[model samples]
Target: MTKPVRKRARETSGGQGRSRPEEPGEGGEEEAVTFIAEQVGALRKLAERHKLDVLHYLLGMTKLEADEHLRLRSKRKLS
Candidate 1:
């Protein structure tokens, strides 16, 4: 013979794992968006600087290859 299993009661509030819902106009979402935008802008600037350095190094090694790289980079920027 098998015994029936009992269901555990769910906590409504004031429990160990209870969490509050986010309210509107709290600015949490807006702050996160602003922070992400700033980080993206900073990363873009760093990438542009790194690309310029790479272009300079490539130019010293091979002008034709550097020109091709620049052309491709410009095409990517346009798209």
Candidate 2:
């Protein structure tokens, strides 16, 4: 007879699940967003320098998102 397969711990565990995403106003999010924006901006410029238009465009969009996050976080702090 063939051996039966066994389920992994994660598969068998009913309570295990993904954690919630961090909201913009939460602590530590601002620094993370700022760092991501900086890194993505650099990558975007590098992609531009190499003529990788598609990759550059995608990174540019991501950069915009991070910048928006920073803006909202700043606005919330000001309020």
Candidate 3:
């Protein structure tokens, strides 16, 4: 049998890590949202075309549950 190993704490500078400020016109948040939306759309289309219940198989969720989750996410995006 193998012995348990102890983990060491990570070292940080001055008890606080440095943070960088966001620059103007970087399009960071907007670009991320747009990319995710495109990918989700593609995945949904692929699932439909292949007649695969992807979420049900991969996530172990019922069809109704997966549909509800997608519906709620779209509703949130609208608002």
The candidate with the higher TM-score, 1 or 3, is: 3
Total clashing pairs for each candidate: 0, 0, 0
Off by over 4 Å in 2: 1-27
Candidate 2 residues 1-79, lDDT tens each? 9999998764442344644566777657678889999999999999999999999999999999999999998999999
Off-target runs (Cα >4 Å) in candidate 3 are 1-27, 56-79
Instruction: Name the candidate that leads on lDDT.
Output: 2
Tens digit of per-residue lDDT, candidate 3, span 1-79: 9999999997655546553444786655445455555566566667766778864254333333545665677798999
Of candidates 3 and 1, the better by lDDT: 3
> Cα deviation in Å at residue 51, candidate 3?
0.6
For model 2, where is the 10-residue window of minimal lDDT?
10-19
Kindly report which residue pairs in candidate 2 clash with one another: none
What overall lDDT goes with each candidate model? 0.57, 0.88, 0.58
For each candidate, give its TM-score against the true structure: 0.33, 0.66, 0.38
Better of 2 and 3 by TM-score: 2
Among all windows of 10 consecutive residues in model 1, the one with the lowest summed lDDT is 58-67
